[model samples]
Target: MRLRSCLAALALVLLGGAAHAAEECPAKSTSMDDIIAVLNAAPGCDRAMKLFEACEYGASGDVQFGEIVEKKCEADFLGHLKPPQKLSYQRELRVCDRKYRNKSGTIYISFTAFCRAEVAQRYSRRALKAGGAGR
Candidate 1:
């Protein structure tokens, strides 16, 4: 009888703690301007660094490309972009390469850095409408 009562009290305490923890968690609020600012203000290398950092933060470690993305590839994309690169939006058709880890077909990875002006233009327009990015 005493053990059952103690267990019930512990369950209630844990449930209450979980509810409090959830309520204390901060909300996620990111704007297009924040993204653009990080991308625009920085030079090629700097921009890539920030992008890699952001991708790392967003990616689950379990993802095959996540670590490589955070450490190596982000700068490569910046290298390919034109000077004074800014985010804009429009739609453009593109293809992506699906890469794999090793000779073994079991672990697969995909890394694609295919963003066209059209997509950027479209995104820019939508971001502007959404009051995210300003002209």
Candidate 2:
């Protein structure tokens, strides 16, 4: 019974350490330009640009600018994900969209900056989750 108790305690400790090792977003903020640089270097720049174009179209008052920007930003993020990662990130993408949905500024620049930050933060977290190696 004592041996079993010790093993159980050890298991919990190991699991707790693993969970702690999973990366969350940094508290230290980054500049919009830095985020943009990261997004430009990421794999989904073309898709992001298309999404940005769609946001621009809607921003011309074809649809609600905020709503379209939010949706397109989420789509751009999801576009970068692999099939397996999509389901995992669905809820997160929605949360990210809602957080930025009502933002107001220059349409192209704002949406680009917003999407860039979102994508950079996602990639940063992913890298940390993979033990500092990016996917």
lDDT by residue for model 2 (12-62), tens: 999999877754322123443333333344354334343333333323232
Single out the weakest 10-residue window by summed lDDT for candidate 1.
87-96
lDDT of each: 0.36, 0.47
Quick one: best lDDT, which candidate?
Answer: 2
What TM-score does model 1 achieve against the real structure? Answer: 0.23
Q: Which stretches of candidate 2 lie above 4 Å from their native place? A: 1-84, 107-112, 128-135
Residues 49-131, candidate 1: write the lDDT tens digits.
33534532232221322333222323334334444443211112122122232334322222222222223334334445555
**Alpha-carbon TM-score of each model against the true structure:** 0.23, 0.27
Error of model 1, residue 50, in angstroms: 2.9
Candidate 1: which stretches are off by over 4 Å? 1-29, 55-96, 100-135
Candidate 2 TM-score versus the reference: 0.27
* Candidate 1 structure lDDT: 0.36
| Clash count, predicted structure 2 | 0
lDDT value, residue 118 of candidate 1: 22
